[model samples]
Target chain A: MPKVLMKGNEAIGEAAIRAGCLNYFAYPITPQSEVAEYLVRRMPEVGGVFLQGESEVAVGYMLFGAAGAGARVFTTSSSPGISLMSEAISYIAGAQCPAVFVNIVRGGPGLGGILPSQGDYFQATKGIGHGDCRMLVMAPASVQEAVEMVMKAFPLAEKYRNPVMVLGDGLIGQMMEPVEFPDHLKSEPTNKDAWSTNGMDHRNSKKRNIVKSLFLDPALLNDNNLQLKAKYDQMRSDEVMFEAYNTDSEYKGLVVSFGTMSRVCRTAIDLMKADGIEIAMIRPKTLFPFPEKAVADASKKPTCTHIISVEMNMGQMVEDVDLSVKGHLPVSWYGKCGGEIPTPEEIIDVVKSRIA
Target chain B: MQSEVMFAGFGGQGILVMGKILAHAAMEEKYEVAWVPSYGPEMRGGTAYCTVVIADHPIGSPIIKNPKHLVAMNGPSLEKFAPTVKKGGVIFINRSLISFGANRDDVDELAVKIMEIAKDLGSVKAANIVALSAFVARSGIVSMEALKHCIKEEFSNKPKLIPLNMEAVVAGEKAGKK
Candidate 1:
């Protein structure tokens, strides 16, 4: 398909349809409500189902129910909406169901504002809901990338039988850009009949598929936790993705950033290059199963002196950057979390200060 | 290598649509483009604005603090955004709605009475097209041919309105050259 100019939110809905995902359950939220708006009309045309629950909490369980029945299901929400859905996220993860969640993050501890933010870094990567729940998180910097990530998320979710997250900021939801839907469609159902509760007659086996998160026995629960932990470990080795910019030259510092913040830093790096002062940036495409080795290796180079994590939130990703660097370099954070994005000039100034 | 245009006006004034048209033009020309709107808390008569960035390479940042151009369709828009426009860029002001200048000498100001011009052509709704076409003619960021084509394609569904919009585009282009 030729590239057509489209808003990020609307394109995401189309991408899901193209990816053969027919079930979309979500509640309306700023910066991302367009997804629901687009899908409500779109789903019917494609013979798919689009449902808006009374609230996000109800919507989350709707996802659990659909995903348990082995239908490609997903939801889109903002910060607080995602918070409301966290319990269902944990339950879905524990039940080992494949589902996709797109969080177009807005600023918040509470109903803060409807603006682009990376505040949910910790929530998405560390603690989404509770108890050994770690979603395989992919962060896209552009609308095209957002579409691509959402398409790739479903297969990855099924690969490990876990929830995969496509984490974007408000800008990725609100902005318009040129996007082309991928030609290939994997409408073929995955090999999930053995686990999915689609009834005994549907699958080859006589054993009924029981989809539940509750493993009441201590040993059984331990086994389930270990199984989830093993999937995470495998992701660490297999699915780490990142982009390294201007890393070839002897740059003074390494910038660790993701999503829209990284795009701003990319501009800053280009400007700094023209000034004869080179700076490198490592943008992690996958937040979890993070590009730890890439960051550590890029920063450990003899020429790279200081490393800084630039973000829209108050130093959330910096912690992960620090953990990745492992004290090899003096790690610091520069941010403006009050819904105001740091410009290229501001990022350039911060990098200068870090090097100085 | 890159140019950023800011379109600001009242909410009902089609500011976002103006920016989208410019973005589509740029994309048709094969330049990477991004259109970001002010999706903040604003009402119908309240403030509305959008920024369009066109770059030869991939657009690095969509959050443009200082735009290369400003097309202000109202008084408050010019006053709020005029100061932030970079020097040596075009600033289009709707003189019919705004009386004051941009208060700067470094930028090029094309103060046109878009509403009056659109009204003279036929309807007042074409004010945004007048302003947009005029600004594109002045800036030359995208070719005039490309801009016109995109405008036609944008109004493709409304076959009846295409001719009027095209007329508005030509009128604005003529006004922009002056």
Candidate 2:
């Protein structure tokens, strides 16, 4: 493996390119703009289309156009821009289109701030748009993980016939680390023509394919919702992913965090452990199918009495932690909104206080 | 405990590179490390600072509002970050540019005329490396082997510049002998 220093945003772009995504559509936003800038030059080199869409709205539609034609497509944006694309995201899910979306999140209630934050956790996991739809949300804590997830997302999205999002924060988007491109990774063009709306040649004209979500009948809509719900149920079993550290030992409480926040939590746990505090962390890699079992299991022990959720948001994921623990254990939250990241010492202090 | 350092100067002054080299060294020394560069408009002809965190274990938060070690290559950087240095922590300043010395009594200040030494050695670009070398030698925060290990790793890709930077490191180490 050849190691090259790369920014998280640029790694996402390179991974998409390697994953055979020939088309990219996005609008500029803080932190994530580097991925777009990287693709601007890189996509052309690889015989791909890189479009700086007129707006996030146009970019979403363009992604729909590309995915409809059976092309591997990708687009990335931050919080507010993602809000604009939520409508198209719903449409893609309704159409059962396979594509990748990267949300390098920033703080936001409404144009909240430019700093990195997990405020969009609920939006990404709960299906931000109207209507019945679900997306595969992968949270990457480092640039290396970001690259690997983007590569893995293609197959995962195709398998589920849904959009897979690599959700992260601005800091993770901008931070630099050595990344190694997977050896022997090759991009094989996927022929999704069976489901795509691209016009078939005369030789294949006898068979027609149309991609639409217009179920005029109410019963059909209900049936579609049921089918979507079933897919989500299956995903809960198939997609939940997490990492446990120092969990084998007797621990006091479990720390729940994701993305860049998890990296910080790991450091905090190490520090507290060295200082004689026996804390552990359950880092969720899949934000949607949130390894709820792991969290619940951690709460089963009487000594592990607290579940602390740390994030860049005010408190988006704490709700999920609460739901997972089901009031069996008290769930607490310590976080900063906007772009501010909580240091390990601060988190250690918070965890110690909670344990006490 | 987490150790934070800020290396700041104008763009093209090698401030960021030096910070990265130090971070890489810490990592090689088996310490957890994080290197965050200044982004946005501040990087264009203005003061640029990169924060580096090195810890015995994993690092948390990566954002240090009060860095323990400061390598201010210019006046503004020293002025901006001086007061935040922890008491007894070292502040290594480039005496050629930052004439206004640090005022904090709690922090230990090392005034190195790194630019003058680099000029004697033939270029201003070496000043950042020299200051880093001086800090490493005097502060003993990182071992010489670790610094050399980091230098080798950082220069492994840019093979052409290794000799000059190594010489600068030598010059810095020699100069820091107090």
CAPRI-wise, candidate 1 is: high
Tell me how each candidate scores on DockQ against the true complex.
0.91, 0.40
Worst 10 residues of 2 chain A by lDDT: A183-192
Task: Report the C-alpha lDDT of model 1 over A1-356, residue by residue, as the tens digit.
Answer: 78899999999999989888999999999989999999999999989999999999999999999888888999999999999999999999999999999999999889989989999999999999889899999999999999999999988998899999999999999999999899756764576785689887777777778899999999999999999999999999999999999999899999999999999999999999999999999999999988999999998889888999999999998988899899978999999875799999998998998898
| CA error at residue B143 for candidate 1, angstroms | 1.7
Candidate 2 chain B, run of 10 with poorest lDDT: B38-47
Q: Which residue segments of model 1 deviate by more than 4 Å?
A: none
List chain A TM-scores, every candidate, in order.
Answer: 0.98, 0.95
For the predicted complex of model 1, DockQ is: 0.91
Q: Put down candidate 2 lDDT per residue, B3-93, tens digits, no spaces.
A: 8888888887888888888877776666767788877446368878889888876455676778899998888888888988888888998
Model 2 per-residue lDDT tens digits across residues A286-321: 988888899888878667878899988888888888
